[model samples]
Target: MLKLNKIFIFTGCLLVILSIELLLAQKQTKTYRNYHFVYDTADSVYVKKLAAKIKKQLHQIEFFFNYKPKSIITIIITRSDAEYTSYRGKIMPEWSQALALTREKIILLKIENADDIIRSPEILLHELVHIFFDDRITTHKIPVWLHEGIAQYLSGYELTVNDRIHLANALTSNNIISLTAMDSLFTFGQVKARLAYIEALTAIQFIVKNHGVAALQMLINN
Candidate 1:
């Protein structure tokens, strides 16, 4: 009986050790301020490179919104599109560089290589805005335009010449999308999605210009 009990104890300990090792291998974490990031060991260099930029952006965002995250935000950085899609559990649009699950306080980023990470520096900032807006604001009934607009605006996304040209073409062709229809813009193809983003940014600019920042802030506050 004593020998059998010793064997069971040894087996349990070995199983526990294996489980811990597996969990550790799957999730290596890096903490900066209120943001807690989980990524693979191989991507440590990439995460470190963006840490300073992310921290600075976070400060600016917090100051702009007058809000700090109440809890540590978990950001998961995936190594490939396949991994990202698996984590998201859906096929995202080509234009979707990153995503935020506001209620869950999670952000997912797909970084395939150094160039890919450097090419879209604003991607994480844009997602951060979504997390901040949803968490900081008290209302849940906000429009998609407002949500996306704020994210783009705060992320320093400006309508480029190409964007304006696209907008002009859209206007001339009578293909301009209405605010109501813009809610499903992400589901559209790449060209249409780009146009939708341009339109949204312009709408936000219009609101800020005509009503002043305070007025738009008041609207969002409620």
Candidate 2:
């Protein structure tokens, strides 16, 4: 009877240890000033580098906007596409690489490969810009085109050769979409969505060239 009791105690202790290890292995997090990076243990090196880049970007963004977020921003690095989709459930588009939940102050990134490591800085900065806009404009009155445009512009998004070809084709075909029509761009099909993004970026460039960055910032503030 005593031997059986000892066996039960040993099993219970083993389960407790396994539970603690499982919790420890689930996710790892590091805090850098206002940003908190959460990623898997396997991504420690990549995430460290990514976090440093993001911190620099955050400084630049804050300096440009002259605004800083009130709370610590949580950046979650998803291990797989499936993990990313799971966060947004059925509504998440398959083409989405990153998402900024501004209200929650959380950014979710789908980091699947070494190439993703190269692209991480740009994507992270893009989402951080979104968060900056959200923090400053709480009324949620900003138009979608302006929101995406400002984010893209400040994040240094450039028109690739393919993007230019797409835009040229769109213009020649008289299929150029107006900025207003892009309010629901994400819900559109992939081809249309890509064109809408290009249109938005061009519109922002025009605004900055003509009206100036101050004017654009004023528009955001007001």
Candidate 3:
């Protein structure tokens, strides 16, 4: 009887050890090594790269605001055009924007996922300007034009005669949406309309570059 009892106890201990080993193996399998990421599968490298860039940019912005920014901004990056159009169109009726962070530390997915474009720091910086000033503004009365134009301008996207002609055509042809009504002009059709968008972004670029992002903070405050 004593021998049988000892055998039973030893068998039970072995089983428990095996179970723990299995659980540890499972836990190890579940762990993901990459940091600053939520998505599975590596289809888009640009998303990963841009996320790092955005983090670096935020350090400068926090200094600009003179506040210790405490927030974990999460961005879900998607490459599907249909997904892009649906999200962007639903929010503000446009789809070509590269980056946007709403008032709540929630940035809508950056849409420009093209490898070449995503690599451009200027485009991300343009959106960062909006993120910085938008968060600083307590009230929500600023014209939509301010955000969009500032984004376009600071992004370093150029404007020329060809873009002007396209925008003029959009306006004269009535293809462009009403300037007063366009809450955010991310997806204007005519080339000229886009040029106008570039111009708006540049205005932001100008303000920050010359007057300062602080000026934008004041603009939003007032």
Candidate 4:
């Protein structure tokens, strides 16, 4: 009789715990402007701010792409590196702060703390640029380098001083990489990935400088 009572108490506690977890999980989701954002209850304010920023960025992306993606987008915000890695699985690089699965229209972002919130806008915009390009351009013939270049360029990602230094060193050493070599940039480790991104950004900048934005747009349209 005493043993039965103990077992029942343990089972009741277990059920209560599961119910609480389910409620918490349900509270994490919020929808805004066709975007479904998921984050912890503690991040409610952060998610609201992010959703507002996304709405503004969406206009910027539409202006650049000349089209808006009509599909619903999902943004998952992870609070730690471990959570981000777990959500992304093996396909994510250790250095990646965010990832956009364009096919699925999902963006996964890792935010360490409140301090990291400032970086979220650019990261979110960058991923949205990828999604916009993928949706606007139906052809699979677009090169990976060009795809990433467009995303970085449209997201307002400029080359930093460190990127300039890397480019200078690569140029001086005659070790500059071709666009084709950058096709697998994300697969490479951190150092190589950074260089590849800088190179791709510069490539798009060069095109814009030499041929102008119209030329770039024409190429994209074709």
lDDT comparison, 1 vs 2, better candidate: 2
TM for every model, in the order presented, reads 0.81, 0.84, 0.55, 0.82
Candidate 2, poorest ten consecutive residues by summed lDDT: 16-25
Which should have the higher TM-score, number 2 or number 4?
2
Deviation (Å) of 182 in candidate 3: 5.2
Candidate 3, residues 1-222, lDDT tens digits: the string is: 979966765664455334333433221111112212323255346555655655565556556555543455434443456644433434343435444534433333444446634545555556556666666665666677775665554445566677667666766877655446555344455444565574555456677789977787677667
Against the reference, the lDDT scores of all candidates come to 0.76, 0.79, 0.51, 0.78
TM-score ranking of the models? 2, 4, 1, 3
Ranking by lDDT: 2, 4, 1, 3
For all candidates, the clash counts are: 0, 0, 11, 0
lDDT of 3: 0.51
Clashing pairs in 4: none
Model 4: CA > 4 A from native? 1-27
- Model 2: per-residue Cα lDDT over 1-222, one tens digit each: 879966765664455334333443478898877888878888888887877766666676888889877799888888788777666443435677888777567787888887887888888888889888877888758888888888888877788899999999999999998878887776788888888888888888999999988888888878
| Alpha-carbon shift of residue 7 in model 2 (angstroms) | 52
Candidate number that wins on lDDT, 1 or 3: 1
Runs of candidate 1 exceeding 4 Å displacement: 1-25, 91-95, 113-115
Superposed model 3: Cα runs more than 4 Å off: 1-36, 43-48, 85-89, 98-104, 110-125, 153-193, 205-214
